[model samples]
Target: MQKRRRFKQTKTLGQRLAEEVTRLRDQARALPPGRSREMLLRKARQDETAIQIESWLRSPGLRAPT
Candidate 1:
């Protein structure tokens, strides 16, 4: 049997990115040593950037992503 996912609207890009980051981290962990370093670091940076942007988007007058 397969499980179904609920279709709730996401409030911010960070929420989406968080899910992606989680997946990336899992993949990074499974990667062979030589291939993991840069990929993991890049994903971490993207996650951090998403967090900052998402927080910024919550500001009273902040602009949405294009």
Candidate 2:
């Protein structure tokens, strides 16, 4: 049997994702308009969406099915 390695994260998932989105946007801004730039922007958008989803999931207003 193999043991799974586990480690604690110092920051919440939202914080990490927000950081990545900021980094991606900065990188994209430095690049000229082209496929590569578009890709970076797309990735940033994806990360932003993930952040939104995570917040939604953690919201106290959300309720599971009865």
How do the predictions measure up, each by TM-score?
A: 0.57, 0.85
Candidate 2, pairs of clashing residues: none
Pairs in clash, predicted candidate 1: none
**Prediction 2 global C-alpha lDDT:** 0.93
Candidate 2 lDDT by residue in tens digits, 1-66: 999999999999999999999999999999999999999999999999899889889989887524
The TM-score between candidate 1 and the true structure equals 0.57
Model 1 per-residue lDDT tens digits across residues 1-66: 999988877555777777788878777777777656667869877897878876877878887765
Cα deviation of 8, candidate 1, in Å:
10
Q: Which ten contiguous residues of candidate 2 have the minimum total lDDT? A: 57-66
